[model samples]
Target: MVFKELRIMRGPNMWSRDHHNIIAVKYIPEDIPALSAEQFHAVQEYFLLNFNDQQRSEQNTLSQFKWTIRLAALLQDKNFSHDLASPSPDILYGILQYKTEQGGVAALETAAQIITALVSAKEPVSFLNASLYIKEINLRNDFGPSTKIIVEAAQARNIPVQKGPAGYIILGQGENQQRISAARTAATSAIATNIACDKEDTKAFLESSHLPVPKGVLTEDLSHLQEIAESLGFPLVTKPLSGNHGRNVTCKIKTVEELIAGFS
Candidate 1:
């Protein structure tokens, strides 16, 4: 069968410091020819220089290495062929799924498809090096039905699943893409489950528990915002009711325009 190039892109979670898994593009052997030797060497040097069998202490470096190694291996094995009598062509579509945590279920599924494709095509595919990450699982927020689909799919195949801070990273991709704001829902779920929510909720929850909240209410109307501001104090904060990361959320609104923008 002919080798087909593919690319898939995704975003990251907001509240988490790690960038959400951003892009999972795929390339064939020929694609690498376009990359200068310097770029190739840089890739090689990074994996070779950092990391050992020891567990990682720093999250940023750890996640970066895991993705780099996995991507390089997948690309190297692009031409791996499978036999004719095996099964469906869908398996041939090898995916390099980007994730925000160490052990990515989607990335594993992608790898599994490649193996299945090879087996059906009569080609040999083997697991190279599998690693794990310690992922923080928050309770409360519902993943809708999609989470169930992903979990079930992984389990049905008996694919090994491990968790970690492997795949999380925010894309600095800037204004072109829609900013992720689902963090509030995620934070609520996390707060319910015992995972620490972001600064805003953390402050609110902590204050409600025993401390002091600035007596703020979530609102979109500037008039109401001003009322709340007057009630609370001069230097009060008006922020998005739902926001993740420190990206779009602002602090200490001194003007109506800033308050309006944040609330809107």
Candidate 2:
């Protein structure tokens, strides 16, 4: 089921299973400049908290977030605009939603367990990282379509939500089922009138085209082969006449063995 193009698609009939809502967003490095300091802070916290948990990729996640913050600061210093001449924003964002009752409970339990362990570790980095993870335990924004659904659901429940910027979706026929029939109709209307020729067919067509083409004989006889070869001149090029992309074309052939190889 889609709510305002945010697909909160149902899963299996079982009540235990979770549903997923998906949204697609495009990204380019240039959009960092438009983001306010608070927005960038939110982004930093988002990566530190949400992404690390989502994919269970904490080490790389921390590294990437640090790199991103550094890059954003660098861009601001350089006074460089993201897009050279275009009017579009430099960055894009998407939201996805997942409906998981058991998953949420499990996540909560895991958070508590990690908090206990973090205190035991007594490391600032470890404690900070664990705290971020705990903070993101309830975060549903990183997943694209989910964010839209959450906002809509909250609104439905009388919770006022300022909607995030709408995303631009570029779908192709390969993924969009609605375009299939139209694509098929267009393809049928643009059908090729001429059928492709096989080797024998092409040989006949080329011979008829008044080109210097060698005559082809049925495999049963050597007499016609020699006769045609003699007529065409001793040093002749032989090839499979119906091939494409230079598949079987042979040139500069003086020996009979090379001719046989070209034909066979």
Candidate 3:
């Protein structure tokens, strides 16, 4: 099968209104045989394990299995009627809705890949190997350890957690929702952040507050940098006027040449 387009669909659609986060795949068909019962069961179990909890009953599992087969059939031909057992068309479209769990998109993509492989293969699929592969992919794409800890902490309190666009995490719901992006929060003071972002300003603020701060000069003029370094003495640090996380920062300059190199 030749993939034409694959995208994440959000908002109201035919399959569901509330559950809008779905992966839609469009493809130009090739000769694909019907999936065997064992292959179908394997694919069903794979999706359930990765996307949904195992606590779901046999009836729920069967329902999901039917849905999976329907979508799989549609991928080979949209016009192919499951009831009539008609021949598949030359073009097809498939949609798979996924839960907003830890892996989410990665899990959905892995399931799709595994299902396609199983559909075309002549032998039984190794679910263990497929699961391991998906686990590695999920680990690579998942949030950092710190972020995961925070998310889990929120979940422990029965707070609703959602993964927003651009890797933001939304905690709670409706009026109580709190969006956390990286280390910043909605209540984070912009004015204070600006002052703290500028090393010179931060140093000045600290000095004014009778707090210990290193003596440093902030200037775009590199010509007088050597003179300033001489006055401040050896073991100087050079950094951008406004920077974070040690970016564009050079430290431990004990000589004029080292200061110049640090500035450069």
Candidate 4:
């Protein structure tokens, strides 16, 4: 049997609410061989071999199949693990929900291909570097840690969410909705954002609010920084003004040599 197409869909796509993020396929119904109960047990048995004592992996025939697909993607290819969920499949469509960033597309494609081989009793493709491919896509598509936690929490609560421009999120429905990225909400003023982005200006902005400000002096000279460090004492934090995600940040310098090395 030949499989024609695979599709990745995000959100309330005519199927059901539970199928928020899904990997979908549309094919002639007869294309899929109706797996016998015994055949399914064999698949589950292989699953047990792949992941020792995995739970909630046998909720239904389709769930077992998903686990088989996940087994090849995570356990065999990546040596990684993710908590699996078995949201009830759509009665009409049988679409499967996935916890995903955009990277889910690559993962599902890899896993579906592997499971297709297994179900057809074909020799499984060997030495596929699916893990590397998945990792690369994830790096490009995955949310940063703070954003991920918020998004997952929203999903768990069944709050509607959609990816907005860049990596920002739109949550809830029209009237009750809000957009956010990192700690900034949709209402966070543009000028406030500009001030925060420029840490040098942020210090002054804080001072205006009667906040106790850290003493800071800007200088390009390494010798001037060393002199300042001597007065400030050890256990210092240093960062570039244009700091981007903790890059080039050196914390807790105990010795002058280490500080010099950090600057150098």
Pick by lDDT: which candidate is best? 4
Comparing 1 with 2 on TM-score, the higher-scoring candidate is: 1
Compared with the true structure, what per-residue lDDT tens digits does model 2 show for residues 1-264?
011121122322212223222222223534222434443344445436533423222332122223332222221221111211124554332222232322233332333243223323422233344434433543432324434444445435433232123422221224431211211222343322122335666556667878775554445444456666666666766655354334467887776777666666
How many clashing pairs does model 3 include?
A: 0
Best by TM-score: 4
TM-score result, candidate 2: 0.24
Better of 3 and 4 by lDDT: 4
Where is model 1 more than 4 Å wrong at Cα?
Answer: 1-166, 169-205
- lDDT tens per residue, model 3, 1-264: 334565554344554344454555554434344456665566556546544524322332223323433433333222221211114555455555543333344544444555566555543245465445545655655556556777767756666666788878888779888998654678879988888777788888899999998777777777998689778998888888876545577887788888888888
Clash tally, candidates in order: 26, 12, 0, 0
Candidates in order, TM-scores: namely 0.27, 0.24, 0.38, 0.59
Ranked by lDDT, the better of candidates 2 and 4 is: 4
Worst window of 10 by summed lDDT in candidate 4: 85-94
**Model 2, residue 191: displacement in angstroms?**
9.2
Against the true structure, candidate 1 reaches a TM-score of: 0.27
Q: Please give the distance, in angstroms, between residue 4's alpha carbon in candidate 2 and its true position after superposition.
A: 37
